[model samples]
Target: MFCERSSGDVQKEDKSSSVAVILCFFGEQQQGGVSDEAEPFMGSGRFGKSPTSPLHHVKVVSSPFHVALKVNFLCQLFIRLWPDGRNLQLHFRSRLSLPLFTGGKVEGEQGAAIHIVLLDVNTGHVVTSGPESTIKLDVVVLEGDFNNEDDEGWTEEEFESHVVKEREGKRPLLTGDLQVTLKEGVGTLGELTFTDNSSWIRSRKFRLGLKVASGFCEGIRVGEAKTEAFTIKDHRGELYKKHYPPALNDDVWRLEKIGKDGSFHKRLNKSGIFTVEDFVRLVVRDSQKLRTILSSGMSNKMWDALIEHAKTCAMSGKLYVYYADDTRNVGVVFNSIYELSGLITGEQYLLSDSLSDSQKVQKWLIYTKNWFDFDH
Candidate 1:
């Protein structure tokens, strides 16, 4: 399970603020006690031995903040987890309302707007319920206007106006902020338990519910969301935080430590490779220089370490590095080469920067090879 929140103030009305929250779960559950061999034949041959069961008893609640505004709403959807399996239910509840101008003008709207959507990863079935009744979850905001006079078909304004009218009833603003809760447990097949010596203990069971508050705004541009995951356990022994040095070959340790202690920077500086700015210039001048240094067969152990570090940094969203001359320096001076390469290549990386880099490089990499999109 995971939870995330977006940054920046959500604008609903000129005076109101808002934010968005997202929660996700890795649905893992066991149902029928089919053996490994017979399992493959249980539900036709399509899924092989995979068991299908609904994520039952899903519940959602709205936040008091929204309720205070007299904006209350709820929506529920039943999605099939398997071809013939029970339906996994999802519920969304919110208590916010769409602001109305004295007349019907939508201009000068500056408040935040919030929207929530649920997607079934297994089947890619998405169910969205919000206050903006006319907005489709797939395409919430209109990007630009179309010129009707020049075009042969319907004009852009007419088309958009039609779309707006068609979707006015389904807009998210009509629903409000949503509160979601989920309950998962063993089914009629019976619960399975593993014991240490003699006690028969039931499997760890619990439910999760979350309330996300976000501001809503016009122009549905993409924004970043943050999330976290945690577990509650009841163990007998006293738990203690432990820090262990990475094994000689552990790539994660290698990457985190790279240039962290200024060792690499110091080495480069000693060899006349001054600041990160200089490094960036060198990379732009000759990308192979840094690659040669990193890929050179100096020590198998060190090479392995660097590779591992890079991978770890890529996964952890910590690929960006910063350098500043003093406390007063406001802008970031340096970033990880791995991150830069990912952006330049158009593949998804853990981090990306726009101000310091050129969009042409980004576009070129995205069109040419696989580069990481950190935001993705």
Candidate 2:
């Protein structure tokens, strides 16, 4: 369980598209009732999701302090009594954020982890203790491409049901161990950690969801709770230092520094594509035309590998950074390659009108061009 210092409120950078999507997920439904002579579900605390819930019934939130870079990992669990008064509502309030370190190493290399926080929603307090159970909590990570928006994108029904949808089209980026142990027995508070070492997490968005199997509730409730879609952010300095690991920082880091044993390295050097930065420009600029890239006597398999290698280099290579006085520098460059990568697609989603479509396109071209200059 986090302390009161961590529990206090912290202001966060504003995100346009997702801010509203979160509100639609928790659901605005009235606090339904629970029957069978309600008693504390935990050792002795009151549960949230109850209007008549004792002072203990309130949503559990994260410590207010967070960085402006990555998405914040926060969740709210609601326990409500159903009209039958026999079952409780296992509702989840999930948050989503993408924490990419500027000029740092891979985001998922160490693996993505989430702490499942259980709370007495009726009470403002966090559940410090774990209840005994044979069956454990299950954690699932789901993702979508919010950057790919449409005219009617943020509808309430579709956004709210994203987690619970049992349809086959669902794209789950990664699934932790079967039967996640939500109650890690950390202490008075019940907290559990689930982690995934998936390679694709770098480019996609993430959300955390939970399920409590049957009989664990001792015939009380069999349901789940989920956090709204959110990713966590590490400060620039904190994140910048994570990139020096040897495994991820290999030959792809620089064309000039590649091992001399390979013919590919020799060819690149002959062409004067020495540093990783130079090679990235060649791949990206040449890739604008498939024929141009393939014209270098490259086989189909070799061409694909080349682009993939370039992508790895772009993702893993560390840039030489120095403190500057007045020259403008862009820290993070956000782009949606979802279409090329076949990530989540939304045909009916709404697009933000803060800028005209043409104006947005113009700004994108200028930004990409500027990025190329800075890297070169």
Candidate 3:
């Protein structure tokens, strides 16, 4: 016999309450107005509920069939919320392991390694899960002909773009400031120095571009020397000093007088004919005559003076002469006559005797002979 307990207490001998009946009553009541009333209570937080928690009414409807249906609905909702769950699961399941090379030294070798750390931006977590999620470090020591102009012909646009493109999808791998050491001998000719001033590399993704730019060694600051000295030496191991002779020296002759007098003197002087000009004019006018006289009996001093004057005027390239022999053999000559004293004296004597009446005529002829010559 089953006897239900009334309001206060029940004897242990009459404890026969059925769990199924209690569940049936709760379900019937919840399906009625109790469910409607519990809807507000579900959101009221009275039961410490959350969005992810099962609904209080639904929890009460805990039949095995309904529970299975709720679980299936939850799974469908989860799949809809995260469609890439399969891929994410696969990525997490197949973790990546990278090989590391510790620092080491070899004899007669210089080397360095770049340490890289990759992180997930969304969660600030180390991205060590997938095979492709890693930082690849390549240690490449580039050596080539630095003097090749082909490397130096980068346009401004190409340079800027090179940097931008390299850094398009990379992050900084360095922390502290970077120091550059440019080996002097390793650079091209006229490279300024082996050490460059310290600079900051804001990002490491652009390091390749920075390396290219730095390798170029452009826009370096140059310092001027306060003073410099140099010494020159001859093959004899003797230090040589520069010696500059005076402008007008002992070797050069100056004109004291041009000619004897009158129109010849006036013409000579007017025509810029100094003593050198007069002497050169006479010799060049009658080279053969002067040579004959010198051969006959001329003083060395006079010959020397004539020779000197001829050389000077010839070197100057300004004297000219003309004359005619007894046979009417006309000749025109352009030269200095200082070297032919015999010829000059002979010509002068002939002219003086032939035109003794007109000194002016003889002088004029001499002067004209000195300039434009027409020997006939």
Candidate 3 lDDT, 140-167, residue by residue in tens: 1111122124432334344344332212
Supply the global lDDT for candidate 2: 0.36
- On TM-score, the leading prediction is 2
Q: Could you say which candidate leads in lDDT?
A: 2
What are the per-residue Cα lDDT tens digits for candidate 2 across 21-87? 2332233323432222332232143332244322223333333343111123223111212222332
Residue 263 C-alpha lDDT in model 3: 36
Best-to-worst ranking by TM-score? 2, 1, 3
TM-scores, all models, native as reference: 0.20, 0.27, 0.15
Report the backbone clash tally of model 1: 52
In model 2, the runs with Cα more than 4 Å from the true position are: 1-109, 121-125, 130-135, 141-176, 184-208, 218-249, 252-268, 271-376
Displacement of residue 275 (Cα, Å) in model 2 is: 5.5
Report the error of model 2 at residue 250, Å.
Answer: 3.1
Q: Please give the distance, in angstroms, between residue 33's alpha carbon in candidate 1 and its true position after superposition.
A: 38
lDDT of 1: 0.28
